[model samples]
Target: MNLLLLKLTLIPTIVALVTLAIRKWGGKIGGLIGSMPWVAGAILLFFILEQGKAFGIQSIQGSMTGIMALITFCLSYAIFARKFTWLPTLLIAYVLYTLTAVVFDYLRLNLMLSYVLVLSYVVLTLYLFPSPTAPPADGRRLPFDIPIRMGVATLFVLIITGLAHVLGPNWSGILTPFPILTSVLAIFSHTLQGSNAAIVTLRGLVMGLLGFTTFLYLQAHWLPEFSVATSFGMAVVINAFINVVVGKIW
Candidate 1:
């Protein structure tokens, strides 16, 4: 339990403080940290509050609710920072999920699948849907840094989660999706480095994804039908491989 809370809060909090002390901190750090554990703990607590227990691995319905709540709370914080825009976003997701949780007794499977389907939509939005209001990464040219950092973070979390899945069937069935990893990473990167486009962020994203793709292909079997040759081939396409070809083009 102590370890869980440390993983959940103290680490991020301390890292954030260190960045601040070192005069490296920039962008929306405070709001980022403020929203994290509060939101996650809220959703986890919500289930415990309503159901009297943690959402077990087998409870797809509960798991999905927690995921959706997380998604809603997360974006809501990052985007609005306590403003009008936040309310509509929160209300819509909350109302929709509320309907599912309350009025729709007949469509449990449908609700869970819908939330999972929304998962990709949210991620693609991370890449495709540019933020209306960005964190104040002042004087920083590396706008692409944070998102790439997020991609890297997601790759790491996915790799670890995949390992857990293989090692622990009982745990796998519980399916505690760390979908917010990318978001959290983006927030942290901005807080730490002042801009997400730090060369490190891009490098980390490309390397991490490539590493995970290899792990998935060689040992983990994440995409069962995807051949190893095909996987590495795509990784090569990220223009990162061009550095190998063009030699120091950046």
Candidate 2:
């Protein structure tokens, strides 16, 4: 019950912060902040407490797979956003993400291999990602936008964590980074701002995935040897460092 309350409070709060940050800072920095593992990290913490460290550690492979699919989702959405409205663009990109997730899961690559491949894929996808054609137009804000974002994010967390026992580690991990936040950001940006805004936001998200992927990768090794808090803390610092450097260069 306590955990449930935490999920209800924490996930929405983080989503609200990310949404407001994007509004204040624009898509790139906001997307970078969104890319952090707040949702996934919280979910992993719950898995560790409920399922055990092994369950959490084993789940990293699936999270890596999910990250790859997330990259595809971002890239595809950015590419399609130029030509279509939010609905068709989101659907097409979602299909691509599902297909990518399935293929990666079937291969069942080792952790290190999956890690390397995903990092490589991130770079390649960024290169292939559509360049922004124009700035987001001045679009009207909708009522209860933040509340809606919060509701969707909280619901996603509830579903994933509630089903942890049933999904087990691998499937849980795959679903961990399942593009819920990405979808919200993309759809909202597309609707409220414009396709260019959505594209920029996704590109920023792909860039931030550098740190996000590393955060998940380290957990595989760290979770077994260190306290959960310590492991997550160190991973976050490293994740921040990677994002700092990548943000400067990319």
Candidate 3:
């Protein structure tokens, strides 16, 4: 099978499952699962397969820096969701995410430094993340919701992977956590439920990034010395362990 076709098919299926899981478990769990490196990991895997191990390594480093942008995005959206409607909130958050990505793109740092910088921002964002004002009201599910979510996920993966060669590892890595799933979840939650729902979802995403950070850090160091399967497997195990610890603490 063609690799891109495989991505288009497999990723959307995973998105659909996660979407269903979100609905089943509630916004916070949804956010937690959603924040996992489903899309980002898949993209990086494709990079390794199609481009080369060296490219994947550089991309992982770039991805660590890009994570800061995701933290900013969730923080911005969480803050704005409390005051503004979904549309304006999304717009402002997207602008901030874009600008932050641009800034991170130019700043050169080794993997350890990037991890430290990102962790600082992550801690700060978690501290600043808005408390949910109220529980989210249940929204009526649309039949097409899953399909729409899948479509959006497919589109994003296609665009990113298609441009991987052109963007190179750095820019591609920067774009990895582009908030496609989070945006979809937030917008839908806001439109259907309310601002509080959106806030909860974004907070979940922010909290979930703890595991994501671990995943990328492991990948950056492990992929060169280990088989891809072994590297990802270990990363997932570590990520799940962190998620459990985070769940207990937070």
Provide TM-scores for the models: 0.31, 0.98, 0.96
| Better by TM-score, candidate 3 or 1 | 3
Reference-based lDDT, each prediction: 0.35, 0.90, 0.86
Q: Write the per-residue lDDT of candidate 2 for residues 1-250, one digit (tens) a residue.
A: 6887888888899999999899898988888888889888888888888889999999999999999999999999998888899999999999999999999999999999999999999999889988778887776789999999899988988899889999989999999999888899999999988888998889889998999999999999988889999999999999888887887887
Native-to-model Cα distance after best TM-score fit, residue 159 in candidate 2, in Å: 0.8
Residue 73, model 3, lDDT = 85
Task: Rank by TM-score, highest first.
Answer: 2, 3, 1
Evaluated against the true structure, the overall lDDT of model 2 is: 0.90
lDDT of 3: 0.86
* Candidate 3, pairs of clashing residues: none
lDDT string, candidate 3, 150-207, tens digits: 9998899889988999999998898887888888888889888888888888888888
| Distance from true location, Cα of 127 in model 3, Å | 1.2
User: What is the descending lDDT order?
Assistant: 2, 3, 1
The residue pairs found clashing in candidate 2 are: none
TM-score of 2: 0.98
